[model samples]
Target: MALKPFLLTMLDQATELCHRLAAHGLVVASDGNASIRTGSGFYITRTRSEFENLTVDDWRWMPVVGAPTTGVSSEWRMHQVIFHQLPQVGAIVHCHPPYATSFAVRGEALDGTLLTETADFGKIAVAAFAAPGSGALAKAVIDDLGATGSACLLQQHGALTIGQTFQEAVQRMERLERLAMVQWLVTAGFPAHQTHE
Candidate 1:
């Protein structure tokens, strides 16, 4: 199917943000994917595509109403499930920021009170470990989304964030990482709780 102008714009934006995510160390070695919904369906990064070198052609268009079973992200199921469940979400970003993934790997839920940004993004939740590209992982993410949160840490995997727009989703991913970094530093040697008193 032909790509619409708006969807093309979103693909370009997603490619740009994907590169930024890689350059900023939020993703490494093709470890993440990003997507934006289109009137035709959803356009997502291809499986194993390097974010640093993503191009418009690297994106695959999946129809929201009748998606095919091929040529999509390995984690297509995750995107499909979430987009299907959350009609309000317009974009989705999945990244493995080091600090945030560390918490996921360590089985630690992000402290919602770590910083104001955390609350602004809503509380982050840690989904139980599930193999990547599996229905189990998709289910875990959906379950996390069922909560009142904007982000979810995929245990032993990475993180996912949804937003009403592509830029918002990207920003939330970046903010999640920043909050995780601050939380790590503070808990390592500084106070465990905020000094808002």
Candidate 2:
């Protein structure tokens, strides 16, 4: 079926956002995935496609009312679960940034309270570890989203953020990584470099 102009726009924007995130080191290679809810179901990036550069034709539409996603990303289940559980989330981003993934590997949730801007981020939850791309991982992410609305850190995997738009979720992912970096620096006693901004 031919996608409407709006859906095509979404595919373009999602592709751009995915590339931007990858350029920023927020997601590397095919370790992360992105998706946006569609009228019938949703459209996700192709399996094993590098999100760094996606064309308009790269999105695969999966119906929410039909058979389960067949050859999509292993974390396709994660997006599926989110769309099912939360009616409000329109876009989802899953990434494995270095600093954030470090915390995830250690099963540590972000303590976003040190900075006023990130105070609300303190509620970010860490979903328990499960085999990657498995139904168990999807359930764990769903449960973590239950504890917070903005974002969740996947145990031994990566980070996931939801937003009314894909851009908002990407921003959340950036903030989550920043918070992690600051916390890491503080724990390591690294002196804060003053920026002349």
lDDT of candidate 1 over 123-174, digit per residue (tens) = 6788988899898999999998784467899999889999889888998999
- Candidate 2, poorest ten consecutive residues by summed lDDT: 64-73
In candidate 2, clashing pairs total 0
In model 1, which runs have C-alpha deviations exceeding 4 angstroms?
65-69, 189-197
What lDDT is reached at residue 91 by model 2?
87
Cα misplacement distance, residue 29 of candidate 1 (Å): 1.2
Q: Please, what is the whole-model Cα lDDT of each candidate in the order they appear?
A: 0.84, 0.82
Candidate 1: Cα lDDT at 122: 59
Best by lDDT: 1
